[model samples]
Target: MKLVKSQPWRNPDTVLAQLIQSCARTRNLDRGKQLHAHLVASGATPSTFVANHLISMYAKCGDLYHAIALFDRMPQRNLVTWTAMISSFSQNNKFGDALRTFSSMCAAGIKPTQFALSSAIQASAFFASLEFGKQMHCLSVKLGYDVELFVGSNLADMYSKCGSLVDACRVFDEMPDKDEVAWTAMIDGYTKNGSFEEAIVAFRDMLRGGTVVIDQHLLCSVLSACGGLKAGKLGRCLHSCVVKLGLESDTFIGNALVNMYAKAGDMESASSVVGMNSHGWNVVSCSSLIDGYVEMDQIEEASRAYISSRRQGIEPNEFTFSSMIKACASQAALEQGIQLHAQVMKTSFVRDLFVSSTLIDMYGKCGLLNSSIQVFDEIQHPSDISWNSIVGVFAQHGRGKEAVRALNRMISRGNKPNHITFVSLLMACSHAGLVEEGLEYFYSMNKTCDIEPREEHYACVIDMLGRAGRLEEAREFIAGMPFEPNAYGWCSLLGACRTHGEKELGELAAEKLMKLEPENSGIHILLSSIYASMGQWEDVKAVRKLMRDSRVKKLPGFSWVDVNNKTHMFGAEDWSHPQKEEIYEKLEELMVKIRKAGYVPFTGSMPCNLEESLKERLLHHHSERIAVAFALISMPATKPIIVKKNLRVCVDCHSAIKLISKVEGREIIVRDNARFHHFADGMCSCGDYW
Candidate 1:
């Protein structure tokens, strides 16, 4: 601009021309107007090409009105002028204006070029105007732009993106020489349109033609297709190819690599890949990692990964926060999760809906039901996510009555319940021992709401009946289900037999449970306990031998208690604590008080061959009771004692704890594997059924 401004003999017309070229390139509209004024003062009328450049520049700068005005003022227009305007509209996402401009250009008898055709076709795709796209295809053929490489590619891309695979393929086949981009577009279109078989065929065809055998983008897309089509073997083959091709360094490919392993049920390998690429922990990558950890129930590892992300200064986004919060709830990391909630507020995600939902779940799992309710209140207009999170919290924590109340309110507010919503409701009812309400919701799931019950929903119903002591009804429900019962299904019935001491049904259930889960020692222990409770020592010994033969190991029991905002965990009779001597002294005092209130040892479920005195040793030293002792000693005299157990508590502990809660005049809430047991006033929430 300064060069044009300083030279007087450079000629005003030539100088103004050079300045307009610079302004158009830089999109300096102010300088462009100054250049135009210089040209008009020199009595020079701008040419068609100059006017087109001005229009293109203004349109590129998002000044659509100025571009259209300049084009209308042009004394003569060419294909270049029309294409420049249409391309600007398409790029700005004003697809409707682009199409109308094309129509007007044609009405004025101006022929369009390959550039015009591509821009118009792409605009059709932007708007999903499939009919208009077809019209553009016809116009391109008549205008002799169909043979151009870019024109044909745009046509295929438009049809493919518009979800018309047939038209996209027709355009692809008509092309003279299809490039790699065309092939990739066609393959993606095939997959997006559910023609996965055709997609695989296209990939193979590209390979046979000596095209690039493997690239990061292509492999990532094809691996995702394998997951969608459930072709695990093919996905593994792709993984081998990716490794051999040395494209594993690509972050997108690496994330897909982890996801492919997890989806194929090879979580051990998935973690290996995730471990090698710590920097690959973006929102998508971390989400896949957390999901895999959750799938394998690797509770602690999930929390560690979340902590690692925070330490790396890669502030967790919504997906990372949502998935990590879910893992925290699963692992019962309630206290640590509270800090994450505060961090979420300081970050840019304070108003995020998914983040709010995850917080609801976190507080809910920790038995902070009121906190969960408060988070729900903050949601401006709660959607399914907010409803499901709060409802699932109650359901998982055994607050069945409250969960139903919330569901009714959600429906009243015109929020529809999804399959997961009903699953949580049934879980709540199962834990609450509400047999009639559980069955009613289960029946109405598919009939009224049109949400078909999955295996999990059916499992909840079986577990629901079992919790209510309707063992025969549970058996009947399994028999009447549309699909064959799964391990969870059989496990539900087996749990009932163990609690009710139904020898005939217990024996039948053990047989099925063994067949379904031959390697689950918990099921073997469950079977043995039922036999021992009924005084069938021979059957108990036989069940023990079966477990020994199978070589299945059970997870050790653990318990957690919160006191003065500090969580204390005890595993078994762990006696190495710094305050072990004082803890036992408090335990002894609690034991004597409960014993005077008619408490007796019920150790029929113990598997060890112990003397009469030793049986009571294992019963009283149970982890839940030990954690309760710690809670009672540390908290105020009448403060509610909250204990969380890793597994379902034995019947003896359940009854003894109820007496302890009454004697101490404290409300003790114990969350076990199945449901919460609120022991107050000498009553268990499960009514002794669990």
Candidate 2:
């Protein structure tokens, strides 16, 4: 095979093609061009074989311009030539051009090969064009290539990307030989479509079939399914598989493992996975851990994870910021929220719609309505979520009129109010005692917005009526519902009955609730409170006994206030704070001052059989009172106290806080499970309705 200078090998076409392929593999465009020049200077007309290799070499080197130039000048094109050009176009993501070339090849009576068909199907997959993909499938069937391994895999992938998992499965089943490519496509498709159970089953089938080899990609898809189903055991098994295959060091595999463990609520395992891959700790892994902590209600851990990620030089993405902000909102941590807002301002994500919407929600939940409004105003073209955030902010602050105004503005701006928008709006009316307006919106759900009232909507209406002391009307509304009332509906009714002291109806509602949620401690507690309020000691005793027999324990109530980026929690008569003595002294002093200013204890909120003085004392030491006292002693005078409670604010504490606000000349914002109460100058934002 030696070449001579006087006479180059008689047929050097094969050698030239080999040299061109080597250049293509190395992506050496200059060397490939030199080879082309050498071929031209040798006084030889390049064969079709040599020319196709040159075209492919230019394409692999990312010189599509040269590739197309060579292609256009080819005198006689073969099937291999057309396939190479189509593959080059597809590989370069010139999908439209690739499809057009395929069509032109067919028009020129050049039948397609399996490689060409695969490339064409790939282009259709990118476009998610099911109709065009079906046409390609029909063509493959006509050419008797449908059962070819490569062609079948591409068709399956195309159908899956088009969201037609049914067709994908059909094509996959018809494949004579299922490879890893075909199996991965089917399993990944199931996961992406939220058919998590189907995905798990398919993975099991693939394993039991013992045909396709297990790989990181297949394991990643299965792990995602396990996460979606919260099947921690299955995820762990997949983790074992990943380790055995030595794929744990792979970046994608690492991220998938972290995400799977996070979704499974195994934060410790998620953290370990992150630690194992410290060098590859990316935003995806960090965000997943933070989001997991947030989901588990561990805001502190979530915050710490975010800080650690930043210290490790992992920049926070929009999702990381959103989850952290949501955690801040959940805890009413204003100082931390402010810090995060400043951080957001320095990043390009400040203009991100998702981040902006989350910022608005955080400010609103932190009792910074003005800041929420400002964030909303800053959005040039606010999305429906942003508008909903503003409306919800108004709703949280008991500004029903303002919420309605925001809704009107949203409509004027051509943003259609979705179910979430109306939920906030209805809750606003309920909190503000705008019962008639709430009913109007409820009716308009179907007539105007074409949204049928869901269970939550019906529950909101019942709450509105209940808040307005219209218990009978609330009951009638529940009865008139299209379906039987769910637990939420009955619970709303029962709470309203308790509020209005309708003991008989409260018992009926409690009965229904017990059947629906027999182990719910709140139902028993609310029913007992109803009996206690009516001075039915014997009935209260019976309800307590029933709770004991059923083993339903009441969840303890606690309130937390954030000051200087630190959260201080308080329970009833809490003595756990480092400055508990000062907090108690401040509480006594405030109680005295409010009493002198005509603040009388509302002992009715106690709901217990006790002496009047004891009831009053117990009422005075509620968690919110202790938290407020701590805030008053610890925070600066200029700063408003924002408290978050795990339960509803009782009437006695509400009244005392109102008088305390007047006595101390301080604004107190308290967020309970139900709504926000802005206590200032002896008045609450709910107008004494909630």
What candidate 1 gets wrong by more than 4 Å, as runs, is 1-216, 223-312, 409-414, 560-569, 593-600, 608-613, 635-646, 657-688
- Report residue 47 deviation for candidate 1 (angstroms): 5.5
Question: Which candidate number would show the highest TM-score if scored against the true structure?
Answer: 2
Summarize candidate 1's per-residue lDDT along 592-677 as a digit string, tens digits. Answer: 99899999888776765568788997788889989988888788875567788888887889988989888888778787876667
Tell me each candidate's TM-score: 0.76, 0.84
The residue-by-residue lDDT of candidate 2 on 146-180, one tens digit each, is 97999998998899899999999999999989888
lDDT of each: 0.79, 0.88
